[model samples]
Target: MAKKMGIVALLLFGVYVLCMYWYIFHSGDGKIPSALQGTAADPVMFMSGKELFLSGEYSKIRNFLFFIATPFEWLIYFLILLMGVSRYFEKITTSQTKWKLLQNAGYLFLLSVFVYIVLFPLNYYRYYLSKSYGISTQTFTSWMKDGVLDFWVSFGMSLIIVTVIYWLMKKSEKRWWLYTWLLTIPFTIFVMFIQPVVIDPLYNDFYPLKNKELETKILSLATQANIPAEHVYEVNMAEKTNALNAYVTGIGSNSRIVLWDTTLNRLTDNEILFIMAHEMGHYVEKHIYFGIAGYLLLTLLGLWLTNKAMRPMIARYGQVLKINKISNIRSYPLFLLLTSILLFASDPVSNYISRYQETRADQYAITLMEDREAAVTAFQKLTISGLSEVNPPLLVKWFRYTHPPMLERIYKVADHEGQKQEIPLKEEQKK
Candidate 1:
């Protein structure tokens, strides 16, 4: 049985590599011809001064290693390794316990620690690479502090999630998938709503933008974009990273734009305005709500597919793997493996949706701010500050990029005539 499992694993690994190659390359040009005013033929020229800083061999090596971690490979090996540990744990814990739920939580915590150990080298190297490349400012101690906090938070969440999931599975053998997925929708929405406010503050300091003049300038752009934001925030990302970013998150009253301090200190005023306008575009277009809806649907389908796939595999491998049932705590490694495989399969579709939304937001920002030159210039700064590839391999972009390349963005701005600014909505008019 173990030998057969090995053969199956080898075959699956081959399929994964081949699928990654074919599915990524054959995906399409991903050009958005429908939404934008016009497609630009040329990308914005990168700044000559920062050429070596961003495109140098050092940056290339880091970027290469970064994407390599993302192909869902590490989790597969972890899944295999943890199966041995899972069986050992199941055997040890089987000695009658009154606190079954507590025992299960301990099992999860044990597994989480094992996963942390397995992946720690990659995690630590990423931090080291950041510091070596002059992108990280946080001390190693501070970085480890953040990591430990993240681990505890994940462990806590997993304890609750696993407890409920297994409870459902035990109650109804077949209907658990439906029930679990239905429960997941709300759980996800709640997490998204709270993350910007709750989870984010744990890692970084976020304050209202200290520069009143800049805050007022951003307010003007928000007014133009119809974002009902009452505050503009600056996260003290200068303490941790040199990368520049601004994003809009949360729902209703929680919604706001957060600019990294690095961006505030590094970009020109015109560039900042364009960046804020881009984030505001996301707010006005209701991308957050739409994203939640899209994810809910995708998750529902994903969980269903996982359930279908696992049934056959468990029938064949369950005894050898020591998983007595779907609800068995020992089966989590298998569940994780199947889910990771499904997520990797779904990446091309998810990324395509993300790219279109991002492209539209860029166009919207250009038109709303009415600054074509700034749009081009801002992307150039972003490419340098972020060390973005001007035009990555088509396959890599298809599988990974949520936004269009710097070359595509700059050229698009050049081609676009810009959208006419719409009148502000009535709700803001009363205020």
Candidate 2:
């Protein structure tokens, strides 16, 4: 049975790898078409920037295909974690007590530390690459602090959630997936609410939009757009990265617009207003609800399918984990790892849905803001600020990026003919 389970696990692992590879190499051009407009083009129009490759106009991207294959590297690291967790669970065969829990947690922590060590190089590049391009404000020490803080926060959260999920899974047996998902909705809501209030404060300082002029303008934009927002705030993003960003989150009274300090410092008041208006458009268009609903549906389907497919494998490999009690913390890591692996393996499908939603928000932004040039400039600035590939490979863009490339967004905004404005640099005034 162990031999059979091993063979099946190896086969499944192979399938996972092949699927990831196929997703990267064979996926369609992941950019929207130049001629496309509105929500019609959204949902699957991430085929624009790749028309160059689709037309076979660029061989450069082909040569750099290996660079696009690195998300698979993330997969391998996660699989190692899965194996470690499985090993810990197997060690729990003799006893399932308080001491066992401590042992497993200790092992998981050590494994996590090991993964962090392995991830340090790539993680360094992810940040330094941004800095090398003049996009990051993260000092090395600050980066290390943030990394450790984030990891522990994540680890703690996952520990609790995975424990609960596994407990539910065992308690409900065959109906575990359904019950766990129902529980997850409320869990998700609680997390989302606390995230801005609790989690965000850990990373960035948040203050009410204290500038009356900017505050008034933002309020006015919300009023004009009928976006139903009362709170607007600015986050101290300067502590981390120099890039600009803004977003509206939550619903009704919980809804608020957050501006990165860099964004406020960089964009003109009018441009800022326009950007805020675009964020308001998302709320106005009910994009948040759309996102939430879509997420739930996808999650439901994903859980159902994964549960169905994994049950047999669980029976086969479940013994290797010695997980008699679903509540065992020892089982949490491996299950979470497998769950993440499955989700990561399904990136293409997930990306497809996400790309659609983003395209809708883009259109919503255009219609809401009615300021084409600001949108275009925003895209351009973001691209430059983040060192984004103006035209990335279809597979890379799809499997990796949530937003359409900056060039494509800029082109769309330009094509729409928004009023252009010259933005004065804050630094230039000091000079």
Candidate 3:
């Protein structure tokens, strides 16, 4: 009886997934605008490139598209939310499960409230969004404490970085992006050095990785890479949730690779090493420098264009939007809400830059690393650990996901290694 029920459940899940895939990818009416199409040689990209080259007016051109594209982007987000809610309710079964589901909904609701309480004080870019996603674990009291810490740190750091960047812009108004890029190299190095000690601890507890054998193995890998093994630290990630993540952040005395406790517990030594090697590839490939340079150029251009275009709009609706000026970050949500509606209508171009950067990192990992098998295993583990669907719709993958879907990544690794491996059996299969 149980076996039959499990099979039925699996079949239902697969059917539901297929329906979503068709809805997102194959549905008609072109819900997305042509400007936001993002396919190769998409109209937005072609026009934007032409404008940038012909008129030397990148700032004006990008913002014009951004304004037009925002509404379409919001629709995409609404679709994502609908998918999430649909999936959440899809697994309902008996009355017992229904009771548990109610409890779970209440838990999530309370969590969201607590998160908002904590973040309302700091109330910056991420706070409200975190609550909206119900991912915030901070309590109301904890929010204020965390907000105080965030304000002090962010305030101080922003002053230094913003002042330096502004000074460079004023000094070299015409060549500001190049000068800012030069300044960013050292700024990045400093942030990398200080982040482990200064930034992360303000949010979560960090301790030394406790496993002797695992520590020894990873340290040896670091030695071969000419990086110091002493900075490898374990974060108490389980204290929050069950997500698995690992990353190398910051540089030199302050530089460290953090292995979330969940990642350490879930992945094998070789898989961990592969993940580290992927991060090292970012450094060795100088992606950090390139990313910062691109961002600085984009920001300089965005700021100039935003001022030119948004000033008139903000003046028109400044009172209605409750934003005093185009530059006010406090009115960020409304401004972003307005901007996003425009940008979304032109999705293809906005997402093209992101997709390019992500794929570049994936390519870097394969080209730079030696442990192809381990890389494949790491991706598989990450995919399963995150509960991500092995396959998502192509359009969804192209526009929404930051990293390629887990299965796509795993397949890429397998292709590079030139071998087929047995896929892992699902939970019901083992039963």
The best candidate in terms of lDDT:
1
Query: Which scores better on lDDT, 1 or 2?
Result: 1
TM-score of each: 0.85, 0.75, 0.55
lDDT of each: 0.73, 0.62, 0.52
Q: What does candidate 3 score on TM?
A: 0.55
Considering lDDT, which of the candidate structures 1 and 3 is the better prediction for this target? 1
Order by TM-score, highest first: 1, 2, 3
- Model 1 TM: 0.85
lDDT of 1: 0.73
What candidate 3 gets wrong by more than 4 Å, as runs, is 1-193, 314-373, 415-421, 424-427
Which candidate number has the best TM-score? 1
Candidate 2 local distance difference test against the native: 0.62
Candidate 3, residue 221: Cα displacement in angstroms equals 2.1
lDDT of each residue in 40-122, candidate 2, tens digit only: 21211222333323323222333233343343344443345335544554455424445544554554565567667766776
How well is each residue in 1-431 modelled by candidate 3, as lDDT tens digits? 33453355456655655665455435542233343233211222222333323322222222223332333333332322223331232233222244533433432343334334543543543444343333344455665677667656755664465445445544654454456556666776677667778788988899888987878877776666675567568888665545578776665456677888888888888778777666665656555566556655554555445345555755775544344553232222333344444444334444566456555656665665666667766765564444333444445555555566554565556543313223333344344
Residue-level error in angstroms, candidate 2, position 419: 12
For model 1, the stretches where C-alpha displacement exceeds 4 angstroms are: 7-44, 49-83, 93-96, 415-431
